[model samples]
Target chain A: MDKTYPSIEEAIVDVPDGAVIAIPGFFAAGVPRILLQALIKKGVKELTLACGCGPLLGATEELTQLVKNRQLKKVIDSYGLFRSATKGLQDPFEQAVRAGEIELEVYPMGTLAEKYRAAGAGIPAFYTPTGVGSIVEKNTVTNIVENRKPKETKVFDGEKYVLEYALKTDYAFIHAYMGDKEGNLVYRKTSRNFNHVMATAGKITIAEVENLMEPGEIDPDCVHTSGIYVQRVLKVPRIGFAITID
Target chain B: MAKKFEGLPREMIAMRASKEIKDGDYVNLGIGIPTLVSNWIEGKDVILQSEIGMTKTGPLAFNDDIDQDLINASCQPVTELPGIAYFDIFDSFSMIRGGYMDVIIMGALQVNGRGDYAGWANPAARGLDIGNIGGSMDLCAGATKLFLTMTHTAPDGAPKIVNEISFPLTVKGKVNMVFTDLAVIEITSEGPVLKEVYPGLTPEDIQSVTEPKLIIAPDLKEIEL
Candidate 1:
């Protein structure tokens, strides 16, 4: 079955308001720019964004635009704020958070990745030693939307670990280097980041690719994300957006 | 702003930290000064791993070689080396939290006497309470050895090697070694032992800048390059 979509707008057209959408990318790498642009045009409000960076500073402008448009209700992220040197240039997500317009939850990068992996793997919960003594263990207040519970801790072999639940989103937005009509995805270099796991964790995964190919074009050995996890594919022009910090 | 106290340069601290990596070791470099350690370990048997999901990463990619998709944790474009492998973030972090990394060099804001270092949150940023956690917590907690590279003192000349970390900790009692501008210190059971100091500087000088009283090593010598 071909999962190919004619347009980026059509691929993301079904995303509803107040949905938990996982956009996987690190910094500026592997971001689904066209899809995000379409998401902005869709103007879905009260979006709960699960992403690597909160609102990537000097990186993708789309996430910042989402925050600026007041479409985000909360952000579950690994990296919180990217401090801009200029006063007025602070990230819109950070500004929204400070103004109490949006909620923010931060986790250790490893734990965040494992949460998505657990969701995709059909695991309900797991334990980790990454955030046993930090604020991540302490900030466990129950919320209305996502029941933020206090993390449970246990000891194994005399080492302490904190219990973390799996994170499953309503939709996963992924950017890929190449995707087959069958939805098989191939990620390039470090751009792989959270895309592979997020694909599996979403109820419906939409992929925007730089190159669209036939089912047999991508070798089975090279497929980073199996087509079984992906639901829709849209081919977009390549966007060069890597931050160079000298 | 010029630092009030002079010691080894940032590159020197990274160079000294690089000495700790043995051949065939897998090293992960955090942002800032620790990222410089990559420059010193070139051609060595050590494999540099970027927490974003890459191993055997080469130096920063320059003109013509730059690939937007290939980058380090710092988000700077990077080059891939021979035998380089890439995976998803889950497997990458599994390699970190699974105790597979040999050494992880990181930057810190404050490190107390008990080996607890605070690197993620900066309470000082205007109106911002939380800072980026990134992969620091996992790298520090899961790596076989954690080598912290930072200035001996904060920009205001306040001792960063303090009696207690003022900022929220990344982890407690995980730092194995500290390479600062003024000295190379090892966090031992006995406490932080001053192993080496910048050439021509005395233990008294380092002690003055450090908030925690240090145990001078009997075999202390000038920091070797």
Candidate 2:
């Protein structure tokens, strides 16, 4: 296990087309931007991407541009459409969704994170009361569950709960504040949003770090994602050092 | 924004909403007027929680003090309090779904007679597309109580306190109280009870815009903001 990779392309070279991926970040913080750029440069098609928010803004143009180029076939996320109410704004992903070019599934903010956590823990499914009487329970698609298992809606002690399946992906691309060659990762502030959960939910978790420390440099209590869960780590260029990608 | 509704100013609405929050309560502040409540409750002992996984988060950060890495659910930079703790999205939401949050102050699009409010999606715009339902559903279901902050009327001059919501409903019958530009209403089993109206507007003016059966308080007076 020395899982460190030389470059973003080498880290993601084996992520074949039609793979499911979980990209961890909320808004502009802690995203695996270089990895996403590598995917864009790789020109892989028919992808299924999972995130806390769908097709993030304020990050890079790579993922949205990929969607614009008709690369993503499906998206699983919590906040899919733009949160604002003002009409006539153009989002290419939303346009693709309306035009039947992309399939979309939305989860409650809590449910989205919990599903991934459950997947990482090897749980099959769990019930939650988040969407009891709303449209989320009424119209939620059940086919996303593994084995195409039919979701069951049951009442527990008078509260309605919907069975949400654990979500696992082929790869998880994450950004961490620091990492060791052995793959232990630490995240900064609120940027730790989904990266910790996503780190465990992917078959192959790849981390892009701002700093790479020695094995004993970081405090034992400060580790966010342990080395046991991460499969690959890429020490990216330090801040302000321009990284050229071919 | 919309001619001020001939009622309380935005600050007064925030002040009134602040009064409803108890000391030592765990609150989730939504965007808009609800965020202003934090500024008014400066010295009061309230623990602010953000769904993006920070508890005991302090006031909004000044531009110079802003860290792009430290942001609230609204994507605005915030400072951490003395006892601030950061967790993953799983533990953060588990706190909400486990009913540890005491109150949630959120903005509203439309609220119906039954106290159900629609805050997330506008059916008129995207027609049931996956618009931002961020933390509304979880907060409504798991929070001990829910408070709403909104203007009395839509920008199109239509009533927002309607008999039924035309937009997609975020949560149903979970709203305990609503603070609006015109009046303060408490949602009871009977319907929305108008407790106080702003000074310039009459019960009739508030009633004209409210489609629900507005039961005026026995001693309705001007809001003391």
Candidate 3:
């Protein structure tokens, strides 16, 4: 726990260009929207973003907007849930691709999250039969499942070879239910995923909390994430506003 | 006897079939034509689910009164019916991953003879990329049954249903039946079993429209006029 950042933008320090980032927002809940805005103001680019679905809240949104505007370079997102009040997901991303402003890699959400978790845990990758024998398996690295005798299928084990990809991140953006002055973070249920593991997988970790409580206020059993991985914190509203209200 | 497509808009076809969806059935609507089914299948029941998260999903917002907080697992803003509840994204995905969904309806870029599907974001098609596999992969893996709704051919007359999928696949051997503009084809181990053809279209006419080999059921019916 090292919560001491006075503002969300302050927590965005140390992020570098071309960093792979993971955030906790599936469709809209638990998205660090305001912090993402601050990160946009912080100006990092060439982002490989992984999340449950689409949209980037902080600097990633800004960078995506910049990419849409031709001021930025590349973005790899598994989902195309980007919404720009000024530009829809299509126009900007397409324009960028046409103008060579960015490259997007659409991935499956569970795979993306699993990859992040694997990378955070320092495992390179694992095999999955999810996309076997289909076009989605094209160009994907193959992993062999080992269960029965390798001679049975003439492969490795009696299992088959499915594709897998590795996920590595430069920074992981997370949302917190509560934070102490020292930066220890607790998560609200369902709104939390990939945030904790993503925090560790990245070179830099940023957290946005709705409330800032004293260090001792968090009950030991209820605390989902310890504060060590969290480098900075910006306290915001209790997911009531300044967040997705739908 | 079932019906075939009747030259209706692709969206209209998907919505019309929503009538077949029963109450308390855990349904998963994939992107594209399936997304519009929500607008048509309204009633006192019929829970709508998007891969993003929300069940009882409503139409996309027309104004700012939209609740951003209320969204499907896909992240699209949606209206909720009474009795809507929230859970962990993983839990919802687990339900899908665990064979709990009763029906899954999604638009497809391509569905091969083996019933493989391609519905991930295709930047090459419409310049739109509003898809992610938050739970559909699991939904496809574990759904009780599946439905597909798309037109018979591409704008260039290329077939979307074929002997083999030419596009990248999202799931292999997962589709049950396909609902296209010209007909409804049920996928069987033997291959595509033609269930019906749209009204006014002959089997010969459909043969000319389709690139893949087709088989007519013993009791093939006409699509609704």
Candidate 4:
């Protein structure tokens, strides 16, 4: 079936309020700018943003507007409080948290990514040694907002590990280098960061591509996130970065 | 004109940190002054790993050379060397936790004599509840060797090398050495020993600022910049 949508607005039209959406981007790279702008225009409220740091300094204006508009109710990320030394201000996400407007659930960067991957792979949970003895393990429950979920800690082979549950979001907003009508995708260089895993972890994965081509256009070997995980696709004009369509 | 070195500039600390990384080492450089280690090290034999999923990262990219899509752990745009590889964050941490990294140089707020460090948060006002630990803990638990790079004292002149840390611990018994603005210290089973000091600074001077007692190394020498 053809997965292409005519406009970014139409692609994101059905995302409802309070949706847990995994936005795939690291700082500014690989952000779905047009789709995020569409969500802004849609005015969806109480969004639970499951992704990396929220709208980091120098992020595209559209993504930054999401936080500026106070649309997100919670953020599950590792670096939500990150303020670039060059940004010269407190992180907006951190400010929102301090103002008691936004809830923050910080994870170690790897655990965050693995939770998404585990969800996509149908794994219930996995244990990691990333935070065995530190405050990360000691303050685990306190860092979460409202004790939304319970984490079980266990020891194996005399080594301690914290159990991180799989994370499945209501939807995923992904940006890619190239995609076909069938929804197969490819991402460029470091831009691929979290998008590939976030796509698979979403209940409904929607992709916005810089270059939308017919089936077989993206070589089979080159596809990063396969079409099976991507349910919707839209093509937006390539902007800013130098991207070559194959 | 001959250059007169008055103090340990950030580049000097980075230069000392760079000496710990041998050629062909798979190293992960943390943010701040530790990131400058790449500038002092020559050639491409050392491969740099970033939490954002890249290996063999080259020097910082500037102006026209900057690719918005290519960035390091600090989110600063960077160029890639030949044979650079990319993976998801999962794979990146696997390499970290799996003991593939030879060295991880990071900035720290405090380091006790036991080689335990606390860098991610200050010990005040529920800081752990909101602190951004990021990958510090993971790198600490994973790296084969951990090096801390920092100034000797806080801006208020408080010593950073202490008998104990007031800040929340990032990892215990991970820091093998500390490359600071004033000295190079190795944390051994017996505790911190002063291995080298900057020019014009005596072992007694370092000891005065240091909260913990420091043992001067038998082979202690002036920092050879």
Q: Which candidate is the best by TM-score?
A: 1
Tell me the deviation in Å of residue B166 in model 1. 1.2
Name the runs in model 3 displaced over 4 angstroms: A27-30, A44-47, A57-61, A68-74, A81-101, A119-124, A140-168, A176-204, A213-229, A237-246, B1-6, B19-24, B40-48, B54-65, B73-75, B121-138
Candidate number achieving the greatest DockQ relative to the actual structure:
1
How big an interface RMSD has model 3? Answer: 5.5
DockQ (Cα-based) for each candidate? 0.62, 0.53, 0.27, 0.47
The DockQ-based CAPRI class assigned to model 1 is: medium
Tell me the tens digit of each residue's lDDT in model 1 across A151-206: 67889999898888899999999999999999999998878899998999999999
Give the clash count for each candidate.
0, 0, 31, 0
Per-residue lDDT of model 4, residues B74-117, tens digit only? 77788988889988777888898889999999999899899888
TM-score of each: 0.95, 0.93, 0.76, 0.92
lDDT of 2 by residue, B1-225 (tens): 344357667777988988988888999888778988888878888899898889988888885788867877777778988999998989989999899998899899899878898887775677444567767788888878899988888887788999978877788889999898889999999888999998889888898888998998898888877
TM-score of 1: 0.95
Assess candidate 3 and give its lDDT.
0.62
- Sort all candidates by TM-score, best to worst: 1, 2, 4, 3
| lDDT measured at residue A45 in model 1 versus the true structure, 0 to 100 | 98
Task: Mark the 10 consecutive residues where model 3 chain B has the least summed lDDT.
Answer: B126-135
Chain A accuracy as TM-score for every candidate: 0.91, 0.89, 0.76, 0.89
In candidate 4, what are the lDDT values of residues A100-210, reduced to their tens digit? 677777777777888899999999899888776676675453344566465567899997888878999999999899999999999987888889889989999999998
Q: Is candidate 3 or candidate 4 better by TM-score?
A: 4
